[model samples]
Target: MRKSRYIAKEVLSLFAILVIAPCFAAAQGSEQSDKEVKQMIQTQFERMYEKGIQNLSDRIVLTGGVKPFAVVSDTGDNVKAIRIRQAEEMPPEIALEVLRRSLIALVKKGKIGATAIFYTADNPNKKSNADKVLVVEMEHIFGPTLAQLVPFTIKNGKASYGEQVVVDMEKQIFNIKVDEESAE
Candidate 1:
């Protein structure tokens, strides 16, 4: 047989689906066969970073907090938000758990790609002059499992967002093992 070749993205997606998804999908979204969606996520995260964080910050300041929500990219320009049946009384951690599981299911089925999940948070770990924070977790099959914490304080009906704190994360979601695949 001629030597086999695998583009980096293809290999990454394969590993993301077979190995990474099962372990990390709980923390983030998983792989999709759609390269366009994966590429969009890889390239558009900076834009997503700006818009998603700011939108949630503004809303959370007004409503006290926002529910667990997500945005999924279907293609380069085709993006949609995910709305879940959230209980008003649901604990914040539990609510985010529900959303994470739901998004992972969608990822396994390849219905979407490059998910960004946001939740309202109160972390005792950091005191940034704010009790409430916006937590955003982004996952791309072709890139890293990334997260950010945007802390903010509200006064006089306006929200003052603090410097965004980067959360250290893993990147094997797209890691691939070509020989391992053939062996299996």
Candidate 2:
């Protein structure tokens, strides 16, 4: 009876180790991956600063008496995640007014969720940072959403600005525009 009890204890111990070891290893790997991703994001921001993308480091203050709004996410991080650092909520009319003043467009109606200063890192699935592009995608909603993607790149320790990308949602196409300041 004692011998059987000892054998049972040994079997339980073995089972615990077999089950937990892989989980422990996987947790450690996940922590390492998170650290790597955070480091990559920091490096990309520094590169954007060097490239004279002033928007990356600048503090944007909205004019007039409007207060800032809370940020919200539309979806989960399936591909890449856009982080909104500052935002302001505006009614449809007020949003349209702001958009028109910024030369975006003139419209009568449609809710503008937020006027956001946001950015998204390039796909981290890439093996190296050299293949990455960090983008600031600002959207001002009038009657429709007008989105802009300002891409910044770093390679061989040199930082530079790429073409400004604009997507036409109605047409489901992207348009590249030259950033005059960066082009200089």
Candidate 3:
């Protein structure tokens, strides 16, 4: 009876090593792959964020106020511009809302790596650093959503921009969703 019990214990140990081990290893591998994907998306978000800021700055320098617009990067890293047209009767806030909706729609239907939306506004708080700020909202489909308030001044069609202040934003683009099934 003691020998039979010992054999049973050996079988259970073998079961754990051959079956449970791979399951645990695969879960670990899935987690690692998720991290890698998030990191790659983060890089794309950063690149597109910078591009959005530059585009806004250039427009402000030339036009004093900016038309809200978007920039998107695809999975292949191809970048493109999307201009949001505002109605003559529309306020800046209304224009911004229109742009936001357009950006969200694009993210949902496109094979997007990252996307950013840009608009200019008077700094909401007087205690804040600058009187004027360009609002840049950015997102990565599998990563994070961020809002950057970029301080800047324009003179002689030249722009001088300060370091941007970043804040965590609610995801409206792709809901920052990644397919866990695929990860598994």
Best by lDDT: 3
lDDT per residue as tens, model 2, 145-179: 33444444444444544455555433111121212
- The list of candidate 1 runs beyond 4 A from truth reads 1-42, 50-58, 75-77, 87-89, 170-184
Could you say which candidate leads in TM-score? 3
When 2 and 3 are scored with lDDT, the better candidate is 3
**For all candidates, what are the clash counts?**
0, 0, 0
Sort by lDDT, best first.
3, 1, 2
Task: Assess each prediction's global lDDT (C-alpha) against the native.
Answer: 0.59, 0.31, 0.63
Candidate 2 yields a Cα-based lDDT of 0.31
What shift in Å separates residue 65 of candidate 1 from its native position after superposition? 1.4
Per-residue lDDT value at 31 in model 1: 53
Mark the regions of model 3 whose C-alpha exceeds 4 Å error after superposition.
1-31, 86-89, 111-113, 155-157, 176-184
Model 3, total clashes: 0
TM-score, structure 2 vs. true? 0.27
TM-score of 1: 0.63
Number of colliding residue pairs in model 1? 0
Error of 3 at 13 (Å): 43
